[model samples]
Each structure stands twice: as structure tokens, then as C-alpha cells.
Target chain A: MSEIFVKDRELVMPGDVLAKSIDILPGNGTYRDGEEIISKVIGLVKLKERFISVIPLSGKYIPKPGDRVIGVIEDVQPTFWNVNINSPYLGLLLLGEAVREYVDVTKTDISKYYDIGEIIYAKVLHVSRSGVVSLSMNDPKAKKLRGGKLVRITPYKVPRVIGREGSMIELIKEKTNCNIIVGQNGVIWIKGMNEGLATRAILLIEKESHITGLTQKVSKLLEEGDKK
Target chain B: MKKGKPERLIIDGKRLDGRDLEEFREMEAKIKVIKSADGSAMFRFGNTIAIAAVYGPRPMFPKHLQNPERAVINLRYNMVPFSTEDRVRPGVSRRSIEISKILKEAIAETVFTEEFPRTVIDIYIEMIQADGTTRCAALNAASLALADAGVPMKDLIAACSAGKVDGHIVLDVNGKEDNYGEVDMPVAMIPRENKVVLLQMDGLLTKEEFEKCLQLAKKGCMQVYKLQKECIKNTYKQIAEGDENV
Candidate 1:
């Protein structure tokens, strides 16, 4: 049997041992050294049946393949568009993968579709070993985001905002009656009725993500909003 | 920058600041002070105040500078013109540059840079006030900021300084003591691992005094580690309670 060293939701710091048994598997924000699983970040320890992981408290987003992200177009080239994905590295959106239709290179204005400063929803196609990001808009769900309240939360807390199998987000959407899109890079878009309430709830989640029983607190907030 | 020496630094086992010879100054640390930065912290050690902000683990600019296997760390240590009694120049100085390099090496000792290949982590430490031992305060604040930013690491770095003054060894030397002290030694370490990352000395010391000073500095750093951890936990504690202000 694997022995857990820390209780669930306990605060852990770097080099803190979370487990001392070989049967215990280490997850993200944790690394195994010898027979010990040690936390690599200042975060909250989460224990599963046979796995242990530490969820970071705060940090910027690092792009990974297949993540859906929202970015702003920074520059436009003939073959590709440079997008700022809220990271140190710039993301590239190739003209060929942006849309289904092909255009004559001699007489096409790509800016009309993705002008500078335009917000776009694109899926990460690849993140190179050198930190170069490649994005694609070919997914049917990906498109230009229209006017909406765009809020940025700590990317590390994205999973918390989403909750188990997206139940938390579903609850927020149902309670506020708003259309919401959460980008893996921490950018969120909210539109429709009760946008303010939805934004408030998201902000709350970002601030209190480390806390246990957060889903209930969010529900209480929404219920109070209903009464008001 | 010179001032007349005080009559005594330690009298009746108390130092100039009313602290015992081995006691530290009043210290306070706060995290998440800057919304714009990925991680930020303000640390105050008595009259010395320093704030550190962390940005990145992001893509490195200047394409050629990217490290394919690990993240590069850039550290900047600066003191405002008004930080001290004299109005120092606003730009980088030789002292600042040297301190910056040493600080970078100290912090790099703990971080697991391999996790983010070809990325860069930028650390900025600004001294808003300076009494003495600003570098130690800055390093402590920067370590907390890195943790606040959630940078993966082996352990948190803690630093403190000790000096010999008036024929006695003192912990956390103030400006007055630093000017006339026989020896000044600043030490940085990974408190959990009990590993030293930074060690610098200026002035003369006997072999026995050096060993004693090292132990004292280590003790001081451990104390700082306790407060730093508490500050980080308090932020989460308030949130865990579902407080609206957090």
C-alpha cells in the first residue's frame, strides 16, 4: 500500500515530501527522487487513490499542444499571422489552416479576416521544443470572438474553474444564463445576460481556487445573486 | 555616506535597534501585491524595504538567446534614488550589477529550470528603502515572489547577514554597524535542504568567528523561512474561509 505523507488540500512547498512509497505515483508539480515523491511548487497537495499531485497556487500559462486558446493578432504576414497568446512566445496562425477557402495570393487582403489587434479563438497545433507556438482555426468551434467581457485568471486555476468534468462551469453558465468560453491561457469570454455575475463568480474562483469545498461557495454566491 | 559612529552597538546584550545581539529586526512579508506581475511580494526587514516581482517562464525574446533544455533566468536588482539618505543615480551601477548577478545565481540554485525549455523567467527586485543588508532582504522577497508565481523548484531560498562589531558578533547588521564593522558576511541558503547557495564576505574575520557567523546567518535565514511560509499560507487561509475581500 502506498503511504501518503500529506493530507488532501494541505499546503506544500518545494522539496516537501508528499509520499515515501514506490506504489504512490507522482503527477504534475511533483517529481520522484529515489523512493520519495516531492512537490516542486508552492501549492496544494491533491491525493488520488494511487497518485499524488500538487496544484500550483499561481503562475503564467505555458502553451501545450491541443489546447484551445484566445489570442490577439499582433502582425500579419502573407503566409502566417503572428498572435500574442499571452505568453512570452508568439503564436503563429498559418493562412492555410485559418480557413477552408483558398485565396489568390496576388489579390487578397488577409487583414479583413484577421486584422491586427483582432481577437481569435484557435487551437494549438504544436508547441515546439524551442517554445514556438503554432495555432490552427480549422476546428469548427474556433472563430473570432465577438464583443464580450474578456477576463484573465491565473492559468493554473483553469482546472478549478472548470471543475470535475466541467460541472463547475456548467453550473456558472446555467445560473447566470451567459455564454462563456474559457481559454487554456487564462483568457475568458462571457456574453449574454448576467455576464457580470458570471465574471464575478469566475474572479472568485481564481482567488479561492486552493480552498476545498469551493464549488459550494460558488453556488451560494449564485443563489445570493438570484435573491438580489 | 559616512556618519559619526554611535557610542555603542550592543549594550546590556541589546543592539542599537533595541534587538538582542542575536535577534533580527521586525520583519513582514506580503505576496500578490502587484496585479500586473505573475508573482510579486513585498518584504520589510525593520527599516529596510524591498519588493520583488516575477514575470515569465514565458518565451525568451531575441530568438538566439533561447535555451532548448532549460529556462534562462534574468535578475535585476535596483535601488531607487531616494532609497538611501543620499540621492543615488537612477541607472544601474557597478554594485547593482554585481548584486544582480549574485542574486540570479542564488535563486537559480532552487528553481527546476528544465521543466520549461527555451523559456525565460525574469526577476526584478527594487529596494524602496535601505537601512542595511538590502541584498538579503531583496533575495528573501524574490524567493517568495518566485514561489508566489508558482515556479517549480527544489526549495525556497532564504538569506540573512551577520557581522562582527565592537568586538562582538551580531546578526543582521544595520547601516551604522556595517560602516564600522570588522567583518560582514551575507549568506543565502535553501532552508529545507540546508544547502548554501550564496556566501559573500567583506572585511576581516578569524577562523572561529567565520564559523560562528555562518551558523548565525543560517539561523537567521531559517527564521525568515518561517515568516515567509506563514505569509504565503495566510493569503490562502483567508480565501479558504470564503472571505470576500481576498
Candidate 2:
């Protein structure tokens, strides 16, 4: 007999058995243990057709392929640059992936292009099973990010901050008159007239991401800031 | 100076603290007690208190120590200077080192280390008050902290102690009971799986008595597990209800 232990959107802790049947497929943050499927992290349960998974509330960022990330240059290697993408693993950006025009490495120093401590917006090209992340700046949207203040929130809350079809962030950008680029890794780059206000709004979103009607609350906050 | 042993730890079907042999100490647990830590928790069992904080699954320091197949656990167990009747030394002691290793092994069994390879998960547990079952309290706190950190785990580990007090096998021995008791044994297990990860005995026990003590300790651990589940659920409940104070 197949049995489901929890309802959709229910909060579950690690080791909590979610279902007992082979008919159901385990998703992210969940695993099959013999006859039962068990939760692997503390998060809200999500059920999709025959699949079930848990969305974690808090944890460090883990790199995945095709994720847009904002990273800081940690080291300037001769051929590749080591970028700290706010994750445990350092992202490697090879000379070929970063630059469109080839300059002889013997004649020109690679550091001149992306020096240490500089920030850049890039896409994850590949991630090895052992957690080695390779980055590429070949996309049209990818470029050096300068003259902006960075704000970090919990990585899991990144989707809430971005909202459905970028609605929440679009509202913040319009009201604060700021240019905001939100990275999938919870790093947000805000630049323009109201950087401070935008930062506060984004942080407020981070703190109350689980709450409903967050968009109304954030807009009210931004409006109040404009008055001040 | 050694204090004289009590004539009897249990009398008239009750122990010194006026509880039955199977009764466990009053327990309290809370999560997210430390803002700076990735995940943190505090646990209390009667007079004994322990707090644990977790950091990482981040890059392991000192390149050579990195494990390519799974994350490594680094645990530290410490008792504060004022935690006991007499002030304990401020640094790591031989006893603390052994306890830390024991606890790390117990907790490592639950965490899914392969999910984040080449990283390290550091757990720091501090004893705020000392009583018998201090290591058990530390284990409980560390387990809660790891779960709170969003570390993928098979199950939470709950620990409790059982001992012979005046020839009676009792669950959850206290400080005075430990001093006068003929035997002391602490047990830690994954309650859901019914798997024992750590067990230590400090004194002699007959085969039947040891079997009885193990059952009593597991029963006590189940009670602790219920408390852990309640506390974790309550924290998230407050968040779901939009209670900002949490």
C-alpha cells in the first residue's frame, strides 16, 4: 500500500519520512531509503505530480551549471583567474573563456583584464562531480561589475527576492531609481541614486521572504524611504 | 576531600530526585540561538546545559586535509571555566578531546557528507553547566545545530545516560547519583532507525543489568527525540505564521 505522510507545503525536518512507496520519485533534498522516502534537509515540502522535494531555508551556496553569479577575483593566475563566487569552491575562469580577443600571454599580463578584488558577472560553464566550478564570461549580459554596493542574502531566498518573472526586483529598481542585478548566489549588485534604500529593501525581502504579500510590504517600505 | 556515599540512591520506589527509575531529566531545546553561526542551538537537561554552533561545508583550510569524496567533520567540546562546582581549566583537556572525537563520530554518521565534497563542517559545543550526562547533552545540542544549518542528515542523534544507583538500574543519572553510583553508561542513537552510534560504560554491570540499562537509556533517548522534533517544528511554525519576533 502506498502512503504519503505529509501534505504539500508542509515543513519537514531531516529524517522525516515523506512517503512509503516506489511509485513516488524522490527529488532534491530528499532520498529513497528502502521502502520509504526521507527528507534530507529542513525545509518546506514541494510536491509535483509524482515527484517530491524539500526547499532548504538556509545553507551555503553550491555552484550549478548555467547559474548567473557575481564573483570577486581572488587570484590572478598566469592563464586562469580564481574567482570566489561566494561559495565553498573557487570558480576558475580560463583566459579563453573570459576574453573575446586573444592577447599573447607572454606579451600581456592577464591581471590587466580581471585583476584581484575586481567583481564580474559570469555564468557557470561546468561543475565537476567533486565540486570544481568553471566560469565563463562569454554571454552578452556578462561583464565587469563596477561602482556598485553588494548585498548578500540567504541563497535560498534569491528566488523570492527576484519574484515571479522579476516582478519584485523590477518594482524595487523602479521605485529606488537604482540599477540592480541579482545573482543566483544571493549576491546583489545595486548602483545608482538610492543605493542605500535599495539595499534596505532587498534585505527586508530576504528577512521576510516566507511571508505573503511581500511585494506590498516592500513597495510601502520603498515609498516611505522616498519620503525620508 | 571525598564526600561519603549516600546510604541509598533509591528509596521507597523513588530515586533521590523523587522520580521513578525510568524517568528522564527535564529537557529544553531551542534553535538559532547564535546569529553569527550558520546554524546554532541550545539544549538543557535539568541542571546541565549545552550550546552548539555549526559552520561550513565551506572550503576546508590547509589544502592537504581536503577530502575529495566527502566532507570532514571537525568538532570541539569544551566546558566553560565556571561550568562546574570547581572552575575547569580554560583550554582543551585530554577528557574534552576524547569526548569531542566521540561526538564527531556520532554526528558524522547522520550527515550526508558526500553532498558537499572537499569541504568541512565544523561543530563547536560548549557546556554551560555541568552535571552527569554532559557529553549526552553536548551530542543532542550538536545534532540540533547541524540540522538547523541545513546540513542534509539521515536523522537526528539523541543521547541519554543510564547507570546503577544503589544496585538499581536507573535512567538519566545525575551528578550526585554518578558519584555514588556503581555504574554509569551513556548511550547515543538515531531514534528513528533504532541504531546506536555511541556507547560508553564506566563501571561493571552483570549481563542482565547491562541489558536493562541499555533499554532504559534508549527509552530516555526517545523522549529527548520527541522534544527535539517539537522545538524544530515550533520555530518554523512561528515563521510560517509571520511572527517577526522569531
Q: Write the per-residue lDDT of candidate 2 for residues A66-151, one digit (tens) a residue.
A: 99999999999889999988887999999999998977999899998999999999999999998889999999889999888899
Chain B TM-scores of the candidates: 0.96, 0.96
Cα misplacement distance, residue B227 of candidate 1 (Å): 1.7
DockQ of each model against the real complex? 0.69, 0.76
Encode model 2's per-residue lDDT on B29-113: one tens digit a residue.
Answer: 9999998899999999899999999998789989799999999999999999999888999999999999999999999889999
TM-score of chain A of each: 0.89, 0.96
Q: Model 1 off-target regions past 4 Å?
A: A1-3, A223-228, B242-246
In the range A97-177, model 1's lDDT, one tens digit per residue, is: 896797776798788788998889999999887778999998987999887878888888889999999999999999999
Report the Cα lDDT for residue B138, model 2.
Answer: 95
Residue B205, candidate 1: how far off, in angstroms? Answer: 0.9
Q: Considering only N, C-alpha and C atoms within 3 Å, which residue pairs clash in candidate 2?
A: none
Mark the 10 consecutive residues where model 2 chain B has the least summed lDDT: B237-246
Give the range of the ten consecutive residues with the poorest summed lDDT in model 1 chain A.
A97-106
